[model samples]
Structures are given as C-alpha cells and as structure tokens.
Target chain A: MEIITSNQNSRVKLWTSLQTAKGRQQSGSYLLDGWHLVQEALNQAAPIQAVIATEAQMDEHLADVPQGVPAFQVTDEVARHIAKTNNPQGIFAQTSLPNNSFDSKYVHAGQWLLLDRIQDPGNVGTLVRTADAAGFTGVALSVGSADPFGPKVVRAMQGSQFHLKVIKDVDLATWIDDLEENNYDVYGTTLSDTSVDYKTVVPEKSFALILGNEGQGLDPELLAKTSANLHINFLGKAESLNVAVAGGILMFALN
Target chain B: MEIITSNQNSRVKLWTSLQTAKGRQQSGSYLLDGWHLVQEALNQAAPIQAVIATEAQMDEHLADVPQGVPAFQVTDEVARHIAKTNNPQGIFAQTSLPNNSFDSKYVHAGQWLLLDRIQDPGNVGTLVRTADAAGFTGVALSVGSADPFGPKVVRAMQGSQFHLKVIKDVDLATWIDDLEENNYDVYGTTLSDTSVDYKTVVPEKSFALILGNEGQGLDPELLAKTSANLHINFLGKAESLNVAVAGGILMFALN
Candidate 1:
C-alpha cells in the first residue's frame, strides 16, 4: 500500500477541486466519498478514474478494482481535507458522470420528477431519492436547480444517484413541451384553489411532476402551461411544506 | 448599544456553549438565531431570557422587542458563534424551556404528533414544522428522540418551535394510555400488512399520529398500542421516504 503523505499531492488537489461545479465540469469528473456512495458508483459501473482511501477504510472493497485504476493510501487528515462533510468514511473516488441522456421518446411510459431551480442541494438530493423510491424513471434538473454533484446533494441522495438518471442544465419549457406533445401530463405543485388535491390526482402511466424552489415556486409562465397544477391541502396553520417533503408526499400519493 | 466585548462574559460563554447539546442542557438554555425565529418566539411569548444581536440585525427588528426584556448587543463574530448555521442573520437568542408539561390535560384536543425515538434533529424539527403547518395542536417527543433545541433541528424547523406546543422526555406507554383515556385514537406509521393506506384512514376528530425514526419506523410498544397502524405504500424502487417527509404527508392527509 503506497501512502501519499503530502496534502499538496496532485491527486488530492484534483479530488478536492471536484467539490466545485466549475472544477467538475472542467475535468469531467466528480467526487464520490464514503464507502456507501463509492460502492454505489461501482455497482452501476460508473467510470472510476481514481480511488483514495486510508488503509483502515480499504479492506475487502478493493478486491473488485480493475487493472490500471489509480488507487492511493493517504493519512486520515488528508482524507478529511478532501471530504465535504466532517465525518468522511475514510474513502473518496473520482468518477466520470454516466453517459446517459433523457429522451422524449420514453417520457410517456413512466413516472418522472422535474425539478425547477431548487437552490438547496439537500432538498434536491432528497427529492431525487424520493423520486427513485416512488418509481420515477429519472429526474430532470432544469436550469436554476442546485448542482447534482454538489456534496450536500450527494449526501441527501444517499446513493440513489448511481441508479437514477440525473440530467442537468436542460430547459424546462422545451422539456415539458416535448413530454406534453407525447401525451404526458405535467403536474406542478402550487397553492391555489384552482389546483386539485394531490391525493385525488390518480397516477398516470406517464407524467412529469414539477417541484420548484423553496422560496419561489414554479414560474407563472410554466405553471400556466402545466397540464395539471396540484397542491397539497394543509388544514393546519403552515403556509406550506418543505419542497422535498411536499414532492415526496405527492409522489407517494400519485404512485 | 452596550456591546459585550469580552469572551469571558458569563452571558457570551453561555450563548456559545449552546452550540452543543450538553452545553444547552447544562445551562438550561438553547440558542435560537435569525430574525424570523426570534420574532416568532416573541409572537408566541416564548420563554426568551436574553436576546443578542449585531448592529445591523438589531436595527432591523429591535422595534419588535417588548419592554423590560434584556436585549444584548454583541460583535458580529460573537453572534455568529452562537448561531446554529454558518451563515447567521446576525440575531441570536437564549430561551428557557417553557413551563408547559406533558400530561393528559393537553392530549384531549386536536391532532398531535407523537415521536418515538426519532433521533435525527433535522427530521424531528422538520416534522415539528410540518405538524405546525398541518394544524396539529401540539407535539410530544417520546424518549430516545433527538433534542428539539439542537442547532440542526432548529435550522430545519425554520422557526416552527415558537408556533407549536412541544413537550419532550415523556414515556410512550403512559402517554398512549392517557390519550386513549381521553378518547383520542392513536395512529402509528408502520409497514405492516394490516396497515391501511394513509389516505384511506379518515382522521379521527381527535387523534394522535406516531412517527418514528428514519430507519426504525416506530417502536414496537407504540405500534401495539396504536388503534390503527398506517403505511404509505411505496410503489417505487426506493424502500421509503425520509421520515420527516412521510410524517408531513400523513399529517396533512389526515387533517
């Protein structure tokens, strides 16, 4: 086991840089830390460019490593420095994004969640995890949504990213238009009397449920275009719910 | 504005110590930060002992302060130190636990959420916020649940603590008995086959819903005591939604 003792190591620096959106895009790589997230990437056969771990964290998981994959042993402090959270499970890997695309052709056959400009990474990640659990085929992240590769989002997704298709930087208008043209009903969460109760809206064979930012919901232009604008009726005093939680409830109800 | 410049000031140290649970409990105080939360506390007439702020934050909401309350002015760094999030709005407060006690007297009214060992503060706080929004009358935190006053929970709730009636450290068995005695039906979130769809369960005119931890759904003791066990059918690939989200969905649906 070769130990990389220096914090200035090129690999460590590169791994740290993946934390930022610009770095990830520039290098075409992102960091997957902790044993669980890394394992998820491996299970999906996500391209692994580099692996860094302390000896204590490596053990049995390294058995499946492919030939020529760069692996390094580093001190706990060095691992912590590269981790987004204070508690790193002493593992981190740099992996290329999946070579996947969301096609309008399949949008009419399954459930999908469309996230519009949700700035909170944790909320976005939780929504992705919930969408996966609710049988959504994939999540389409429109412009203004939090970066999927952001550390907070990754942690919230809790390993669901490996199995789910996360398409970012797409135009919501065009995406919804394509889906609607193919007979997909798009439901957006809103708080209006005109909106149908989420529970009453039966699950469709093909639908796109759009969730918006925590502060400002879906834009008026997009809301007007939605096939069905839905709202969860709250009998209580709360004005609304956490967007991720609201999305989860709608997903469960629709499913 | 009399600024407390010394780190050794008894009040300053006490505020700083609230960053951890042990410190919060030892001093019998919890730190509530941000203008909205402080204002919410004021609105509820919560047991706010001391209010601290930086110049900018003070200027914004100082007029809302009631007469005779001790309001302290501290350095920006001091305010930030006591604040739960790294990004503080520059307002911080120390509040004592309310005099309200958890007993049968408070159980006979409207909907209430009973948490059994839900350890994550964020989940608990989010549930509290949702419960408040859903119009629940109060919340009873069973043993093993996370401290509601913890920083993570406070941030997640977004100032809901002020609006909701909260009672912690109660025995679940005794609490259930009292609720039943008071003619309140108990509904618990479970994955059991006998559990009905949450939407189908018409909430009793007066009932208490029990939500458990993210991993552990509910305590077996509570489950056995519940008049009805309910489950949100997860039709998707994911096994479950985050407990906080699930609780929010169920609370709104039941109401």
Candidate 2:
C-alpha cells in the first residue's frame, strides 16, 4: 500500500497532464474520475494504467480493484489537486486510449454519428451519450470539434464511451465517401433547399448521421457528399435547436 | 450617460447580486448579459430597468437601446466584475421578471413543461430551450430545481425565456391537478414497472410533461398522480440518457 501526501509528486503531476489533448497525445492515457467511470472501465476490460484514491475512498473500494493493478492512496489535498470537479470524488483511474480510429480505407456498416466542428464540450459529450442510447454503432469526431477524450467531454459522456466506439479526429468527407462505397446511406442534418423532413427517412441498419456545429450548420461540401440532407423543423420561434438535442431527436427518429 | 469605473460601486454591486436567487427575489429583476439577449429583450418589449455596457460596446449597439431606459457606460474592469462569463460581452440589460403565474383557478391550453427538481443549471436551461423549440406553451420550474433566472441557466437558455412563459418556484403537485382540471394530460417521465413507453402517448393540443432529477427519477408520490407515467426505452447499453436529451426527444415525439 502506497500513500502519497504531496501535490508536487511526479505521479500526481503526470496524472494532471491527462486533462489536456497534448498531454494525452504524449502519454496515450487519459484520466477517469469518480467511481462509476472507474467501475465501467474495469468492467469493459479497457486497459488500465493505475487506480488512485483518497484514504477514505480506498478503504471502501479497495477490494473491487483488480488484482495486480497498481493502487495508491493520496491525501485529500492531493486528490483535490488532481481532480477537475470542485468537489472531488476521491476515486479515479488512468486508462489507455482505445484504438478505434476509422478512415477512408474501411467503413463499417452500421448507424454512425459524425460530429463536424462542434466546439462545445457539453454538446460533444451529450451527442456521444445520446448516440449510445439511440443505438448507434460508433461516433466520429472531426478535426475542429472538441477533444473526444477531454475531461469536460468525458464527464458529460457519463460512461457511454465504454459502451460504444468513439473514434477521434475523423475526416468526415472521406468517411462519408467510404460509407457510400460500403452501400451505406449517409444523412446530413441541415435545413437546405435540397433537405427533406427528418421523419421522412426510413431507418435502415447501415446509415450514418452527420451533425454540424452549433453556429454553422453542415458544411456545403459535406452536405453535397451526403445521400440526403435531413431537417428537423423548429415548430416554434427558437432560431435553432441545440446541436446535441437536434442530434438526439434525429438519431432516435431515424433509428 | 453615467460612467462607472470602480467594481465597488453600488450599482455594480447591485447588478452582480442579480446572479443569485435571493437577490432576484428581492429585486424582482435579473441581469441579461450579451448583445443577443439584450437585443432580444428590447425587441420583445420586455420591461427593461436599465442597460449597461462598456464605451466601445455602447457605440456599437446604442441605437438599438430603447429610449427613456437608463443607460450606463462602464469601464472594462467594471463590466468584467458585473458580468458572469470570463470574456464579458460588455452589453447587458436588467429586466423585470414576467408575470405569468398560474394556479388551480385557471390553466392554459397548450403543451407545458414542468421540471421536477432538475438540479443542473445547464440541463434546466437546455430543457427550457428545447421545450420552446418543440412548440411548448411554457415551462414551470419546481421549488428545488435550479433557479430559472440564475446566471448560468439564463446563459444556457440563450434568450428562449423571452420567447415563452417561464414561471419560477412552481408547486408541481398542485399544478398537475390544475392541469387535469383544464382537461390536460399530465405525463411523468420515469422508468418504472407501470410506466408506459413515451411513444405510446398521442399528441394533443394540451398536455404537460414532467421530467425528473438527474440521478433520482420522478418522486413516487408525483408518479402516482400523473395521468400516465411515460418512459423512453434506451435501445443500447448506455443505461440512460441525459434528462434534457430524453425530454427533447419525448417533447418532439408527443408534441
């Protein structure tokens, strides 16, 4: 049993870096905070680097930690320093990033969600969670979208990443072309002259839905590549729906 | 035009207090930050107590500010102090809360959203915005839910409060009975043995949807009083959906 009290520990500094994309790129591991995420990752058999907790949390959850996994007890101050939330849960795990990258070479035949430059972390995370709930096979994030493994987005995802494949940094136009090659019907959500009502599209097993940014709707190039552009009419005066909510309603409607 | 440079000025202090529930309770007004929100309130003819902006912002948007309304030109430091966001938009309005209260004697005939103690400000605001977009007549916030006029929620709402009725501190139980008296179907969203699938509900002109808290679903007592408790089935293994996303899907489906 190892107990660390200083916030300046080398291991603590390394763990803090997992919150950023550059840090994650350097280490190939990201932090998972709170008991539920840690439990979910353990259950899903994702590669685990380490388990950490405050003394109180360790005493309660130690038995559940798998055999041979490195475990440490840290002071509450150190726990607070490493955790993102104001009130730290005191239990966390560091896990290897899953290798679920997709490209133009091969496109799987299933319900896929492609996010296009959706910058808000909350929207990105909620869309991923909603995709999982709506029975999507995977979610693909484009280059300018929020970091898929970023802390805020991961917290918003609420363990759904472990349940579904989340491929980061996807080039959506090429991916759309690959899906066409695989006989997949690709749909873009934008209100354009060529777009049809979202409900008009019948659900097929192998179709992908592309959601655009909060401010900018789908890029014209991406919309041109899609099989059909779908629009969910806002029945009331709101200028537009939040991208995640729009994605949720569309995913469920099309699925 | 009054110019305020010090953060400790009485007017700045008063404006800052609007971020809290108690302050709003006493003052009967809340702050609206950013150009879009202020412009929306002005366009909607919402009663404005005052407008404040930095000198640069004042120059850009002064013509849009309604006549006879008090305006202040504040320093950038004061604007940052009074505004909630890190990068203050510099333009703001202090407006009187709308008078749209309802009781057993009278209930409106249209779709309504009753939030049952949903705590997250982001969730509450997103739900309200979604309800507005889904053509809801109004939204009612229960006593324990996040403050309807709180800064974070209002920012999340993105001026949707001006488009529809938003009543705060509502007693949901009594309100449900009142809605029933008005020939409205009140639906409670909870996943339980007796709850029916949300899709089973037929859309009608008048109905109220009650969404529960994030972790705890609907209160059992509240569930018993609902015309029919509705549930949205999650097809995948994510366990559940975000309350706002679930509400958005159900609202559009049943609208």
Global lDDT of model 1:
0.81
Per-residue lDDT tens digits for candidate 2, residues A173-254, read 8898888888898988886535798867796658999999888888889998998889887777787878888898998888
User: lDDT by residue for model 1 over B160-210, one digit each (tens)?
Assistant: 777778888888888888888889888888876578888788864799999
RMSD of each: 3.4, 1.7
Report the C-alpha lDDT of model 1 over A1-255, residue by residue, as the tens digit: 578877798888888898998889888888887887887777777889988898787675677666677788888888888985567889888999665465655566777888889998879988988888777888988888899988888888887877667888778888889989988898988977578888688865588999887888888888988898998777665666889888877887786
- Stretches of candidate 1 off by over 4 Å are A1-13, A45-57, A62-87, A91-93, A100-106, A192-194, A203-205, B1-10, B17-29, B68-70, B73-78, B81-87, B191-200
Model 2 spans > 4 angstroms off: A84-86, A191-194
Model 2 chain A worst lDDT run, 10 consecutive residues: A100-109
Please report, in order, the local distance difference test score of every candidate based on alpha carbons: 0.81, 0.88
DockQ of structure 1? 0.61
DockQ for all models, in order?
0.61, 0.81
Weakest lDDT window of 10 consecutive positions for candidate 2 chain B = B99-108
Clashing pairs in 1: A117-A144, A133-B238, A135-B236, A236-B134, A236-B135, A238-B133
